[model samples]
Target chain A: MKNGIWVSKNGRVSEASGLQPRDALLFAPHGMTSEDLLQEQRSALQQNIKLIRTRLAEATRR
Target chain B: MAKARVFISSVNEDGLKPLRRSVFRVLEGLGHEPLMWEENLGPWPSYQNPVEKCLEAVEQSDLYLLFIGTRGGTFDAAAGVTVTHSEFIRAVDKGKTVLVWADAETKAIFFSGIAWKLDEYIAHTVQESGSYPAPMQALDFLRSCQEAPPHIDPYVWLLLHDIRQRGIYVEDLARGVETDWRGYFSDLLRRGLLLLPLEPTIAENSNRLEEAETSFDLLAALLPQVTLEPPHDWKVWLNTIRERLQGRTIEHRYGRWNRETVGSYEACNAASLYRRDGDSMRFISCCGRASAVRSFALNDQSSYIALTYAMGPRAEQVYYTESGQKFFYCVRSGPFVATFHFPAGSSWDQLRYIRYKDSVVSAIIGPNTRLVKLVRLLLGGMRA
Candidate 1:
């Protein structure tokens, strides 16, 4: 929450719950440079993948 | 390289957009986390006071980079000090890397009292003491903060670099002693362990040298007789070593309790291996004691691992336990040792334990130790 990205207690995005698309825009605010946008996009994609993995793990465990 | 979290305290409303932008860009280019009010603290929840949180951030930062301009900012009536002024003072009192970059013109503005305080600090104590680096302008000051001071020993430099990477604040390095590096270094010099020559070229050059080379030099100098490879996973190795000790039932010899032991031997002490400015490591606080133990154990265990790695792992591990007290391990590796000075324990108790362990270890490893029996006993106790 501090960094605009929702984080679990461990300061990481919870893998069991995928992040919403809107939340990924936290790092890519208006007037962001093209380079920053590219970096943010890459970061967002990674976060999405982590979230998906977490969801998969939770589902399997359940 | 560890990126220090730098808290930039400048008057946001002072109409210095270009300066702020350049500073931010420069900091980011140098691989630092620059925190400021505009991008950070505008959305504080109603329940929390933004001013207090801002001060807290200053205390927690590794470097306090203050840019004094014409604006005095708002005065907090309750605190009787300007917000920016208060933040600067807190940074100084807490013994952070207080770097002030005041424009030449800003000296006339006494409304905040920052300019005078900084001037006084530089003129009297800092200059007279001849130990601290005098305050400089923004660009020069920031660059100075980035460079290791000339007096730092090569070994200490490596220790600082490694521990700083782990986000330890310099103030917390020698916990329960001097929270700041200046004080700790002074103590080291007093003890004759660290020497400050007329020109400390070794440390100055050591800073630019490759990491592996610096580490190797430190190891060679400290443990010339013993060539020890750095452990790949230091914590796992320590745990393995601890297990070996436990399996051999070495704890019983030093312990007051019977062999049957219950409850966790979680680390009660959470001292940093090397404290630096603006290094904050957060632990998720759960409700229960067990959870707290896990949190602290992680902190202390990693700290001890880092310490051993930096100092080399020629160590002796001992466990002490009784019926009621928390069971703990004292690991004395190379020149460094860790004791159970838990947050819950009394200050007297912590100091006493540290002194006692230091004495015992110093005695056994004295330069003139001719008694093979004591050496064998200590080594045999460690072998398990």
Candidate 2:
């Protein structure tokens, strides 16, 4: 059975082409400061909230 | 059970003697072969440098039991680290399974992990003493320590507390220790007696002196529990308790606790007599002249209280409550302080409570008994 994996960053998605410096910094394993990782997480959460809001608006209009 | 070579590591200081012994006994009871410097290594000068020998022992051992007490321990001047502290570092570096048991009072300081060495630990202590926030953790640790049970060996408990049910076991174990000091040194030492001619280590003589001092202190603490002159308000409190216990039958009797050996003398004390209810269900409270005997009594009392609450009518929460200026508690096989427990399916916070007082009497009475004399001698010697 394939073990389920938790993807914290997009590194697993594109192994052929390495991530950009900014993306690398955002997804750095240990070197990136705690604040940087937290900021990245916060941004991802904000994007999720925006997408959820858009879907809700469309459902309400329909 | 899979066997492991477990090394018990602690400073040979007075305060930690009880804990070190308890841990050693428990490990052996759990079927682990326990090795300790005191038992395994020969006394001072036999090994040119004992600390290196201890480290080599730790390297060979599979499990390390490290007990941290109040004092950092005697300085190892050559290594510039406390002996116990250095042993802990070496044990950790060697990739052994390290189980660190610390006094609740010192847990915070240990948890900080700030001081890698004893000198730093001492400096940290001084700085913490002068500060507010740092000392807060230490104070909390002390308050918690009071609520925790004294670390005692299961075998020791079987001998001292469960003697009625396990008298034969105690006798057998005592017989084994009569000849072998390796397994039972601390138990015999703390009880205010010792069999001489065990090889003397550097710390052995000073440790014996301190144990004597502690015995005097603990005994002095314990004697006041059997009060012919109960505190002025004790009668009032007892009356209240008696009123609470109106339906329950209470009886009293004078008897001798089973004879045990202390320093070649077969010593027995007049057990303080008090029983509640019929023969089938009775609680015995004993008091005696020997301070060590009273400590055994106290141990038995605490264990009995814990067992009582455990057997029938499960308590939602159990704690020691203060009455007549002493600590009283009935708990289930563990240490608990004066706190209320809220159980389910009950309008009330607690179903039943156990009360025993004079908890702090030992802590208070024992130390002060000799500290004054020591202080006076120090002062006089200084002036001279």
Among these predictions, the greatest DockQ belongs to 1
lDDT of 2 by residue, B304-351 (tens): 232233333321111221121111222221111111111111111111
Clashing pairs in 2: B249-B277, B272-B286, B272-B287, B326-B358, B327-B358, B328-B356
Candidate 1, residue B129: the lDDT equals 60
- Candidate 1 lDDT over A1-62, as tens digits, reads 12122212222222223332321111111122222333564466456555544434432342
* Model 1 spans > 4 angstroms off: A1-62, B108-384
DockQ of each: 0.01, 0.01
Q: What TM value does chain A in model 1 reach?
A: 0.46
Q: Report the C-alpha lDDT of model 1 over B152-226, residue by residue, as the tens digit.
A: 211222222222233333321111222243443345346433333312454344344435445644643554344
